[model samples]
Target: MTSTTVRPDLDLTHARWQSGTQGMGDVEIAFIEGYIAMRNGGTPEVPAVIFTPGEWNAFVLGARDGRFDLT
Candidate 1:
């Protein structure tokens, strides 16, 4: 299983709640060398999903190929 982490600090009160947009509309996507992070745009001071870079890339590719279709 891919190791993941959720940021312990972030706020999501004003983020534009979006769905089917990576599972959360209020979230934003970002990444570093070995970690991918999804955080609430409105509340950047609350928790968010963090995944290994590899896993994040895989998900991206899958989404590109219709593998992550929400419908």
Candidate 2:
């Protein structure tokens, strides 16, 4: 996992974030620089995961293709 600084001036509380599964209302995704930052709901101060551009692209493609779907 990679770590990056989220802009303090930005407010992510109301930002929209989606995870692989439902029922997680507090999850949010933010693209910062060359990485994708995922923050848990109500915890904007911390990031759950920071994916690199390549990793982010792979995840996007996988999700699009339903590769992450539970079998």
Candidate 3:
């Protein structure tokens, strides 16, 4: 993967999100594959997390199941 900075807080609704190395670059999304991608809009050169669709679903499910309880 390419070394990059993070830019979280980016406006996704307005971002022209794209994939690969041929995009606006200003967008805040990068399609990693059929099930995952990178997202970072708080800094411009920090690496971001990549999550598969299934993994994301599991996380949401876990949160709902109290697996992420914080008290």
Candidate 4:
């Protein structure tokens, strides 16, 4: 599993969370301030995963290349 350490000093309340579906499911993914947050179905809470600009770039590239595919 990919792990990230959330900064306690970051105030996410004002953060603009852009939500979208990850392929097909009730699960939701949110992006804000270089952080990606996921909320599963039937859940009310979501933890934000912090990522650096470089890491985010790599993730995007990998995702585009289907490196995260699960079949």
Q: Pick the TM-score winner.
A: 4
- Model 3, 6-71: lDDT tens per residue? 434433333344554665444355444443445555464665555566776787699789998889
Q: What is the C-alpha lDDT of each candidate?
A: 0.62, 0.67, 0.54, 0.60
Order by lDDT, highest first: 2, 1, 4, 3
- Candidate 4 lDDT at 43 equals 56
Tens-digit lDDT string for candidate 4 (1-71):
99765554455565555445355655554566556554553453555555656677888799899999997
- The top-ranked prediction according to lDDT is 2
Q: In model 2, where do residues sit more than 4 Å from their true spots?
A: 1-26, 42-46
68, model 1: CA deviation in Å?
1.6
Instruction: Please give the distance, in angstroms, between residue 24's alpha carbon in candidate 3 and its true position after superposition.
Output: 30
In model 1, which runs have C-alpha deviations exceeding 4 angstroms?
A: 1-26, 42-46
Q: Candidate 1: deviation at residue 45, Å?
A: 5.4
Residues 1-71, candidate 2, lDDT per residue (tens digit)?
99764544444445556664676466667765555667776866674577777787898899889998887
